[model samples]
Structures are given as C-alpha cells and as structure tokens.
Target: MGIDELREWQAFDSVNPIGNYRTDLNFAVLAQQIARWSGHCTEIPSLKDLLVIDPLPLTNEQRAIETAKADAARSQAYTQSLIATLQSRVKRK
Candidate 1:
C-alpha cells in the first residue's frame, strides 16, 4: 500500500514539482528511482570485465609530471566536493 501510494504521488509530482524533497533522501536512491522512471540504467561494472593497459613508456620527468597530475586531480576533486558542501550549507539557511 505504501509503495503504491508513493508511485502514484510521484507520477503527479514528476509533472509538477510539488513536494518537499528533503536531503534525508539519499542521492543514490533518488538516482535509482529517476533512472527507472526515465527508462535509463545504472550499471555496476564487475572487476573482471574491466581492463586497463598502459603500454607507453615515460621518462623520469614525464613520470613525475604524470604522478603530480594524478595527485592534483585527486585534490581538485575533493576541493570541488568541499565547495559544493559549503554552497549547499549556505543555501539551506
């Protein structure tokens, strides 16, 4: 009964944005529901199906640059997430 009501309510809500969608609802859960309703898909890939092979050789300087780039990218990704978190905090108030 609960799921049926949720589905019916959501059908109307999708057309006209009417409810309070709280942050208590997880993003992953929202994404899954959206994907299902929109007829798209979210896939979890298996490790055996994935293959990454790097055949190119690099010099010492080039290797250092690549390593630095990877580290910088990791830092940048975290910084972006931090900024988004701060922005969301500002929005909620």
Candidate 2:
C-alpha cells in the first residue's frame, strides 16, 4: 500500500481498529497500514498525533484494579510486621 492508501485509511476519526466489532478485519487493516508505514514511509506522523507518548486516560475498571493491587501489597507488609513482632515477644519470654 502507498501513502495515499494510508491517508485514506486514517481519514475516519471514529474508525478505531481495536475494541469494536469485526475484530479480525479491523486488526488486519490496522496491521497492513502499520506495515506499510514502517517498511518505507518518510515523514512519519508525530507522537502527539499517534497518542503514544501521551497515552489515553485509564477507565474506572483499570483504576480499580490498580487500587486493589496496592491494597493487597500494603496488607501483606502489615501482616509480615505483625508476625515479626510476635516472634520477638516469644523469644523474650
């Protein structure tokens, strides 16, 4: 595919090839354009335009998962500290 075809593919703003219906076809089209761009494309699009350097905001589900992981880590640390205190008291007795 050429630059003209690539531009044509990118013309639609709401045409995300991910997280939508028609999974197989969407991925195939996205892959084809990316391969063409990477293989022999001069003057690539900027990072801002691609939204790679500055990523999209996380959804509520993602934020909840991160919070749960952090909570589990803190709980494990507190449990370990309590066990160490109990062992030290037994030794003293």
Candidate 3:
C-alpha cells in the first residue's frame, strides 16, 4: 500500500465501525495500484501516467514474466521519450 492508503487504514481500523465503504474502496484502489505498479502491470491506468513497465525477467517461466514486464516498462519509457522529443523538435521548428 502507498502512504495514503496505509494512513487511511490505520485511522479507520483504530476507531471506525465495521463498514466504511468509502474509505475501504479508496484504500483498496491504492493497494491495487501499488501492487500493479510494483509488478509493472500495464493494466493500471493511474500509474501509466507516472511509470513505464520494465520488462519481466525470463529466467524461468516466473522470471520470464518479470523480465517481460520490465521490458515493457522500458519500452514504454523509450516510446514516450521518443514521441516527446519528436514533438519538441516539431514545435521548435
């Protein structure tokens, strides 16, 4: 979980009743986002704006998954950088 979600959980767990749906959802989403970010999962829309997927490792099937994820992350960074540079040059001209 990110800082935001952790704090929210601590606060709610300490005092609140059993069913605060709003806070629960916010924390859940944050946790999911953090998990996805760590895994370099491209399905997360929020972090897509912030991160690129590094290709997942390919040592074994599991490692390969990680290598592919890392590669994808790097690829995303590369593609985005290329586009940004091209756009900047076009603008300058």
Candidate 4:
C-alpha cells in the first residue's frame, strides 16, 4: 500500500485500543479481519519497500535564485505592459 494508506491505518490502530485477552486473541482476530479485507496475509507492510523520500530540498542559495528568477519574470511582464500602454498612447496621438 501507499504511504498515505499506511499512515491512515497506523492512526486508526493507535486510537482503537485492543485490550489484552486470552493468548492475545483479540489482536490476532483483528489482524485476520484486516488481512482478509486488504487481501494481504500480513496486515503490516515492510518499511524497506514502502519508504518515501522527498525529492526536492532547496538550499538557501537555490531558494534565493528561484526567488530572483520569479521577481525578474514579474518585472519583465510589468515592463512589457508599460510598453504596450505607451505604444497605445502614441497611437492615440
């Protein structure tokens, strides 16, 4: 399953407390039900197979560069608009 589904299961398990019964039978029964519904023999997945990593972590320099590029693009767009306005005024004259 995906990371989100695993997280949701973990959250549900944490809140739903299973008290100790004979030979931990309550937990076992719950596990079986979950397995049957999920179509997996084991309710839990191996972490090695399911681990997710964030692909993008920007350094301060990289962040600054991106901010500067965005600012430059906005400035270029504004300049283009001003030029268009001036050309329109010239045409009116």
Using lDDT as the measure, which candidate wins?
A: 3
Model 4 — which ten-residue stretch has the worst lDDT?
46-55
Model 2 stretches astray by more than 4 angstroms:
1-56
Distance from true location, Cα of 56 in model 4, Å: 2.9
Q: List residue ranges in candidate 4 displaced over 4 A.
A: 1-55
| Model 1 score (lDDT) | 0.67
Residue-pair clashes per prediction, in order, are 0, 0, 20, 0
Tens-place lDDT per residue, model 2, 1-93, is: 999987877775357654444554455557557856787766554433443323446689997998899999999999999999999999999
Residue 63, model 1: lDDT of 90
Compose the digit string of candidate 1's lDDT tens values, residues 1-93: 799999998998888556333332344455556656776556643322232322366899999999999999999999999999999999999
> Local distance difference test, per candidate?
0.67, 0.68, 0.70, 0.68
TM-score (C-alpha) between model 3 and the true structure: 0.37
Please write out the lDDT profile of model 3 over residues 15-62, one tens digit for every residue.
864556455556666767786769876676553233333223234887
Q: What shift in Å separates residue 15 of candidate 2 from its native position after superposition? A: 19
By lDDT: ranked, best first: 3, 2, 4, 1
lDDT of 4 by residue, 1-93 (tens): 999999998897688543433335545556556656887554564332232322256899998998899999999999999999999999999
Worst 10 residues of 2 by lDDT: 46-55
